[model samples]
Target chain A: MLPLIHRFIDQAADQNPHHPAFIFQERSLSYGDLVLQANRLANVLIDLGVRPLDRVGIYLTKSMEIPVAIYGILKAGAAYVPIDPSAPLDRVDYMIRDCGITHLVSSPVRKRALHQLLERDTGLKAIVGVDRELLETDPLTCLSWEEVLQADSEDPPVKVTDQDLAYIMYTSGSTGHPKGMMHTHASGASYAHYSAMTYGVGPADRLGNHSHLHFDMSTFEFLTGPSRGATTIIIPNEAMLFPTRLADLVQNEKLTFWYSVPLALIQMLALEDIGNRDWSSLRWILFGGEPFPPKYLRLLMDMLPGARFSNVYGPAEVNQCTYFHVTRESVQGDQPVPLGRVWEGAESRILNGEGQPVRPGEPGELLIRSSTMMQGYWGKPDLTEKSIHIEEPLPGFTKRFYRTGDLVSIDEKGLLAFHGRKDRQVKIRGYRIELDELENIASAFDEVQEAAVVVAEQAGGDKELVAVLLLKEGRNLDSAEARKRFADHLSAYAVPKRIYFPATLPRTSSGKIDRRQLAQEYAETA
Target chain B: MEITKMPDKSQIESEIQTHFQGEGIELERDEDLFSSGQVDSMALMQAVAHLEATYGLKIPPGDLVPENFRTVEVMADYVIQRR
Candidate 1:
């Protein structure tokens, strides 16, 4: 049993030396090559003073070098902080200083971004995997990939326990500050083991990784896929924007398991003529981060009868706790596929505002205590303590349950159903309403492709709900009829006061609907 | 009678460069604009607005994919063909 996350790759390399661990474009990195190359990188990092539990930043695009940098940092007994190469230099500097990342692993392809970062006073010590041209500052050192690979292929002399910090994932906070979520080797390994066991992943499975390196979903490919010695085919960034190209990649790679947000799969279904393509190679489709529009999901289910769909439900704080297997029959209706029971090694509770359990079938905040949960928000003790509820059920042992901030309830079938977010609830003219509820009801209309509900500030600093909708091509809506339709399901105060049509809805980097952007747009226009 | 000159690829490239210049970003002719995280949906919208206003070509929702605007070169070619 591999209790250490880094040991997963070692065991895989021992079992399947020739097996491909990661494939990008036409290049492939075999399991043996991954271990050997990672060893060299570990030695270079150790030489560069990357101590145990120290944070090392990985600043590179979606490429083969990612897995190598990840395992290498782990082997050095250091936590790898994956910095988005495309992020602005200011954010990069903040993360580097926030986590005390003195060293970064990157490639020459990012020299332009690296050069700008070096121009700033970031207090960085050394940069690896790039040329000396990146060493703009006097104190900064650079080691090219050639120089790093010149080191001996031997494991670093490091012993890491399961409780050691393995990685720190930074998420944009609502307050405009970024919070890093620290995960230990125990949490990472537990999630990888539980997910692999639940999904019955084996060496025969070929996982298609669609999530960005900074996104939480990348864990399946980096940790879970390697634990079972399965191959991961990385869909490059170029392929993601083009659905037709993505369809070609799925067929050419023969990926057995596909995982991403619903928006990605929705694009492939809508833009690309995927009806002519064969999706027979796929066995599982896992979607999370946001709810899938049920209308498009129904079409995808019909198109890919060979695949089984699972609605993965969890916050970035917990990685993932529950997976609801979707069926062709379930998506036939407009209702979303329910969030299924919690997977093994996880426990959940539905609690109300007073920290008491809600009555069965009543909406409440979903709280989860799992081995797959994060340690806490990095360096934000107050925020960390606020997000979790500690219960000393036993004499000394305490169980921590993370408050998901999401509202949910158990159905008659004992399956969890998601409601709108608690923070998304707002009071308009002293009437409290959930914006997500209004958006959901409006989007359920056949002519509506997508809809977003936002709160716009009024002339006298009052707030009103505004609905920005994207209608299907050639579809028109009568505002009076639409408002009447909304009135059928929602209260008069809860209904949006105005509706605006847009050519397209703006999406964030991870492809979630940008509600904050919509709210600001309407606020300014109003 | 004033005759409007047909917009060429270089002219379109300059327009794209000027669009990014307003945002303080140095536009690369061949680098991926979208995946590089430099051009987000909002940023791409500005470029689309420029293309429509300058080239007088409507970019339908179907043709608004990244394949047509992956880079400055790609977006220029798209404008030339559409114009």
Candidate 2:
């Protein structure tokens, strides 16, 4: 019964009506104005047959429309499924179908791609774009975002309970096919409250939106910022790849808070003659999504001497349950930055392979229990039961906890430090990757008989993907041709950096490819 | 393109070598720096900063990919061309 996000919007509308909630490109929306627009859109959805518990997929980018769609969905008593506009068509299509989406809210420019996906999958019943042209275009019942907001904003708000489904997020699908992780109103609100309180986010703060809505980290910037009447600035997708441009945006926008992957900070620190910008306003810099290199900590502390840094750690299943405060003392120490203690209302444990609790300093699977934990994997009861569990054996605690596939260690001070993924999952630039997804696609290539893709840490600690294949005996495929084939199926990130046409890949007696041997062989050679 | 006296290729290569300290890249001017694992993205930035500070030229953002930073010779030529 928390109604966290909604309560903030309503409060802002009444208390800080003129304060900016979002500042995009050249436009800004006051708190009252944003809530009013969201209310209008909610009325539109209700008019279009949306009901309690129905799913509405946001097929948009990190634009102003995103928050509007989110609040509108909530106001209509429906759950939201946010699909990253930049995600591969297959990933988006898979998520929409998996969530049983009946409506999609996308941008006008993104309509063609959404149409292509909808053509193959009949689950998406309506595709609404974000403008007047989209509204005018009557091609098979399409409506623009403006058309939807044309409804009266004064309609009595629908009754929504805290126990109701608020959103269904797809895990980056690092282990396999993306599974929908369901959440309730209370769970989503818990994180929004915790993030704002921890960072002291308020109207004076301006948060950066570089992450896609699909990633759980976006929950902190996109939700908490706007909810507090603060300005949330969207970092252009292309600008993120170019450090200078990203720096310019941050400087021009005067961003006060930024949360992104460690890889991005590495890129920023690498820029040539990267002049110290007027970052005096930057109060906090949060990094997560994977283990950050010690080098990053050294560089950032040297560069931004004044800003406070914190390393956030958690899985998408339970968004941001722990944070390690990065003070001047921790920076001067020899140890790698710890992921730190559990956040409020969160508990964690390190368990051995047999599900027994491990001693301190020993690496084991990390388990977490929190209010923000996902309701369950949507439409998969067996999966829900397998992934989430009740206490079977523990000396002191008897409660349910979510079993994270990540390997971690608990320090003597009870701080949790992440080691690596226990499963075949790997994180590249904060994006969870399922190696099986790459292998399954690579196996589909015409000239490949068997493809085993292994990731290796090169010198100075850079992870590179190397594919070792046992091709058809007489067939020879050059690296260029093999890479081209891989590009056709997988995204640029999933493509292996180097392709090795080995005579035969080493296999264990159990008839499984020995990844350890491949890594060792490639580590020295790559 | 702004032109400055091209420093001895050997001197530029020496600077690149010193910056890469323990990194395993041959100190040849013509050898591919990126593909041979001699310089990674971070090392490339270090090299770029050195060239910018020493040679008085600003490297554009678009030209900062691995292809352009392939070799000491290529980087020197690019700096000369862009200057």
Chain B only, TM-score of each candidate: 0.87, 0.67
Tens-digit per-residue lDDT, A1-526, candidate 2: 4555666787777888988887777788788888888888787778777898999998776567888888888888899998755445666677777778887777765645554664674465566655544344334356676677677897346777778899988764544366788988888888787888888898889898877787788888767886676788877544554576677777888889989998887787777756666666778899998767776687787777878899998888888788888877776755778989888868887889888899999999988899888888999888789878687477876677898888889888888887888778888657777787677767777778998888887775678788887788788888756765654444445557678988888999998889888988888443
What is candidate 2's CA lDDT for residue A164? 83
Regions of model 2 farther than 4 Å from truth: A130-139, A174-176, A392-398, A444-448, A458-460, A472-490, A524-526, B1-83
Q: How well is each residue in A334-382 modelled by candidate 1, as lDDT tens digits?
A: 7877888888879998999998998878999999999999999888999
Q: Quick one: how many clashes does candidate 2 have?
A: 1
Each model's lDDT comes to 0.81, 0.74
**Whole-structure CA lDDT of model 1:** 0.81
Cα displacement (angstroms), candidate 1, residue A325, comes to 0.6
